[model samples]
Target: MHVFEGLEQRIQFMVLEVAKQVDETLRVLISPDEANIEKVTSRDDYIDNFKSVIENACFSRLHGQSHLDKAGIDFIRAVNIISNNLERISDFSVDIARQVQYLSDQRFLDQFEYRPFFRQILGALDIVVRALFHRDLSLALRICRAEFILDKLYKHNFDKIITRLQTGKEAQNLITTLFIFRYLERMGDSLLNIGEAVIFSVVGEKLKINQYQALRDSLDSLGVDLPLREVDFESIWGTRSGCRIGKVSGDNKGDSTGVIFKEGKHKKIFQEKINIHEWETILPGLTPKVFGFQESRGNASILLEFLTGCTFQEIVFNEDKEFFEDAFFLVQETAAMIWQKTLKAQPVPCSFIAQLSKRIEDVFVTHPEFNTPQVQFCNLMIPSTSELLEQLQQVELEVTAPFTVFIHGDYNSNNILYNQKEQRIHYIDVHRSTHGDYVQDVSVFLVSNFRLPIFDRIVRCKLNQVSLHYLHFARQFAQEYHDTTFEIRLALGLIRSFITSTRFELNEEFAGSMFIRGVYLMELVLAHQGRPWEAFRLPDRILRYRYY
Candidate 1:
């Protein structure tokens, strides 16, 4: 074989070896009767060794050749990608093995049906193997097609198992089922990832979710059930924490078990939590689906399905104007909903203040100087408290002037979820909701905006603030929520709180504090309104949001 061809062969051989190990690991994980967990654990060493050998071999080839042929370079890159995928597979397999060992001592096998679980793993593995070994376009297509099927299957199985356990008669059995469900679903995902890699190699096109769906549909028409649907919440016997436990009704227990469809399928829609169940109801938009809640579980956790939307921080910083518009609108809508439906006058938690104080202490006490040439945390940028407090007190006067609404604690851009397709904005992670001075959310959101550039540029020009970007976004946000004086107060209060909390490290050389930023912004707002700082010239960027 030629150099490039020889490298392809080597990668193909490695893929086959990894695939074999994966297959064994899946079987060992599913086979409750056998104690093969240790056997699978021991096999990971071989996979790791194979990966290291391939890395070295690839490196050697690059070093030995003065100028590699284009085809040879392409082949090497492909081999590297394949090697990385194989290593990930190995890591996942080891995790599965460990999970299986944990489940071994429990009643995992008794509640969860391992047959379908094993099949999902096997199907995922088959797709990856075909992509690597044969380079068959059809096989690559099949692998790409399996991701959604697997996702739906996992959801179905998880819901079904949870429902079965809810009847609560077999607490031990339920615990076992939980572990099995979590592991099987996780392993299935690893296999799906492998399939995605295979498809990427063959088509040189990254499959969007919609593309995968089309492929899945095509395969389904040919009688291949690529992705499957699951059963309802009531179908499985389950128990609530305080509710009395009961046996699965002979009538309800025989609900159709979730299946990996081969082509013929039926659509069964389960009622999402919005249809029933009452908790902290965020008006439906671009939010994660709350699966259910455990009232007596102490901490009120809404079982939220995973979300894929990127944070506003990512969008704004990337300078994607299209995404930024969507993010801006989404935040606006979410704020509106909170004001209209959720915001209520309530007592603030003592714990929140304590935590905030601790955060300030940790940020400033040890690093008492701003001059240190080290980046502290990747996230926060704090300023010295004493320097920023006077301006903040002026803003707080506006906040405490009788309008306090609910605060979305930690109201940074990261907490909002935007759906581009649905054109929706949803509030998420509401576990920290507090009825504090509305300024808490406004301050966090505004100051946090300083962390993003597009907004910061505007603030820097307008306010010459530390987080100039944030001040700009906050000002616009404040204008948008014009219906409530509470919002303006909240915004002002937020700045004040930010000022009080601002503290730099012990060194002056490190960076300017947020207190400085707050002072700049406070002055800008006053200047813009023709109040005290009216003579101050608004910077060009801040003019983007100039009052009409």
Candidate 2:
């Protein structure tokens, strides 16, 4: 039987109950009779009971014997969310009705246009059943827009109440009236949530209304001619950057390869768009081609050509020895070509410590124990996190890259994709691509590989080998370029990457290992401060995973 066979009618009944409560609450505001107040408050229990019953049914279907398709699952989820929000609206109505009791005069609310608030809320509520059941995008948009309109109404009434309160003529009445309007505004908020739940059901992804609109605008700007309801959105999780990334494809089309839709702060998305263009100029086909970009208010969205290939992380974990080696060779070759083409003979001061400082707070937020105080260990004085960073910052000023090259700001393994058939490597997230020290990329790449949580001995061994191989290649490049402080600079870069990388890792043993490696590197650099930097050696043991 249908996934939501019994549940859909119950949710519709619940919505109707909430709408009636709101209607009674509005009448109580217009004329606060005891009976109207009692009617609004007493029915809240029925609405609450309806919510429980619907919620239990939704969960039961979810955990039932029959398997549900993605659409069925999404519908159940949307139904549950919609029911919860409808219950909230009912509660808010009771709250509004209670506030009417404090009004010194019921007509005090009449001075303000409160009917439009009810009209907006009730009109939106009238469509909840139809919009959610039909999966109608236009109806969902209408429901979402009611929140914006109600917000405007609330603001207008709020200003009027503030002005009247300044007169001290009816301060209590004005405040009580404001409370009623606030509850109405909150009811509008519930409508927005209900509308977004419907959108989620239609799209099979949880997207805020603004994000959905941005995606639609981005697609329209590209002349994609696809409706929002007809598109499939598959969320790309595992990112800490607070950006919404998804793979979008036309649901009706079988041949669509899909495109990457990214939405975030305008500054970041815009910078990425600019950076992609720069990469195209420096090396065509190195980055994904931007299909369209749209910025509205403070947020932006971009549609990018989705690169079809396995990420470098996938190859390292799943591919055979020959395939992994071939991919690694391609990575090395790509780096060499990009660095050679974009190299600028200008000394850029190392900002490893500075970058570390920016993210150290985040590290401490995740692993507070990493922020230790100075400790005594035999004859040596171990530095605290702060003390180590301060010393590194002082020494970092003296070191600089002899030449600058365009580097991927985030050189993680997953960000680099390799297409075996075409034998090509493409960069996916190019927001941080710019002219900078090459060691930045090198250090980040090594740490990214080391930070993978794979514990299998064979995979870990491969990771260790690849990290050392890449390090050797970077050292060779530095030597050829005559970067005098290459070793010291790389040590600083590694220290920065290793320390910040721990913030994303939650495994205590693994995170502590990375943190200790960073501290050890710091001590090594600090000890060699007065000596010649070239003689300093990077211990490979710190990079390798050792079994106890």
Candidate 3:
């Protein structure tokens, strides 16, 4: 048998041994005894020895061979990462034991709520062990998710300690326990890193385990072993915040799966699931089939059917001028069709005004600098973002929809894909699809065309024309259906687009233009706040809304 034959089993055994030590340390953590501390401390030596053995074995194997395949290297990396994490976890257990030795009274440990933290870490360690050996991406995701659970548990317990301190609890006892929790939480983090490395060894996705699990769940229903293309780190947009989008090239030409990873307060993942449900269950083939999703730990991910074609954004910016009108019309027509889509569910009041209100509220809170009177849109005087929202509240919005229809909550051009050859319009990012006002769809359609970040003066003029034309088209459609509030509604939609889009616009000048355009729409709405909905006029067109 080769040395590499039992390598995984050896690594697994080493990890299990450290886990045993962690359990012993945790046992002593609840009760302070000099002998128990010595035992836990001694376990760290064995843990360190195993770590060194694994490290040396990995290096020796690598140095002994001139050309190792990607799988061999990745396996070595995974083993090393797991060893390092297990060693750190053992070290943390010893640290916990040391902190326990500092305790003047063992009663404080009993007073604390640490069972959950211990349970989570141990559970995570077990999951990692299984996932590492079996290469179960799903179990890896659970291990990754467990770290998040433990971190939150740590924070909750930390707050309890601080609150106890503020109330005059003994600092020494509480501080010692706090250090133990901190060490355990750090161990959880190390375990999560290990899970990532393990998944990378198997999948080569280079993302965390939760992300890998999302992909696994997404593909489970597809029933294909389609080769996953390399994800370019540079191509993954918005790495820090909001929705992170990535593409893996598909087997068929022009077909590539799109990935959306979002983190933080907002939960768009659930909404996207509903959207795909509508597409697959209610309106098949109009939108891409969603494979699956995972929403946890304040993060959400969506795996979407690869819709191949130029996005309307790409078409508007890169395609020739002759295709512009067709692109705009097709996208608008698709939005109209989505609006005309019917289902039996009870429809809610139109959320156009409600969405704008929420987005503007978020704008003021996140980008307070946009709340000044210094902003302008083509000589249009604009005040604070909050003031604009107030004016919107004062306006009498017609909540009763002219016709309740399924609308893409975010009907931006970026989300619209057109395949001219197939004469099909494909929609992406449908997290906001809902039964709402068609006017909302039209409104989003208009501003999405206007907010292209290109700096070319000619392109700006052309974009403005497309937006204005689409507005008229929407108005004409609304008039045909006896919905007379298209003008006012579009203004409200522009405000949502201009303000909310700033979250994505990185260019200083371009973001400023979006803000100004949004403010100008606010000014337009306020100018005609009390007027009849039919009497509202469109704002002056943008000539130079571009990035430098």
Candidate whose TM-score is highest: 2
lDDT of 2 at 9: 85
Cα lDDT listed for each candidate: 0.48, 0.80, 0.67
Worst 10 residues of 3 by lDDT: 226-235
State TM-scores per candidate: 0.36, 0.60, 0.52
Over the stretch 358-465, how does candidate 2's per-residue lDDT look in tens digits?
989767755667889999999988778899899889999888788999998878787788888989899867778889999999988899888776789999999999
Q: What is candidate 3's lDDT per residue for 352-414, written digit by digit as tens?
A: 556666666445433445657546889876565666676576673453455667777666666
- After superposing candidate 2 on the true structure, give the runs of residues whose Cα lies further than 4 Å from its correct spot: 1-255
Model 1 per-residue lDDT tens digits across residues 1-548: 36655556666676676667667765765573345766566777877887777888888888899788654554455566667766776666666666654553444564445555555556655555445544344454445444444544556566777787788765565555566556555554555555555544443445443445354334323221122221111111011111122223223667432211111111112122333222244454444554444433221223444444565545554456677666676676566556556545443322222333345443333223322232446685443353333334453343232333555655665566566776766554443454555456756665544432222444333323323544455456545544234334433444444443333111222124444443455555554443432132334242122221
Q: Find the number of clashing residue pairs for candidate 3.
A: 0
Q: Residue 248's C-alpha lDDT in candidate 1?
A: 30
Positional deviation of residue 368's Cα in model 3 after best superposition, in angstroms: 4.1
Q: In candidate 3, which residue ranges exceed 4 Å CA deviation?
A: 1-274, 280-284, 290-305, 318-325, 338-353, 356-368, 373-383, 396-400, 540-548
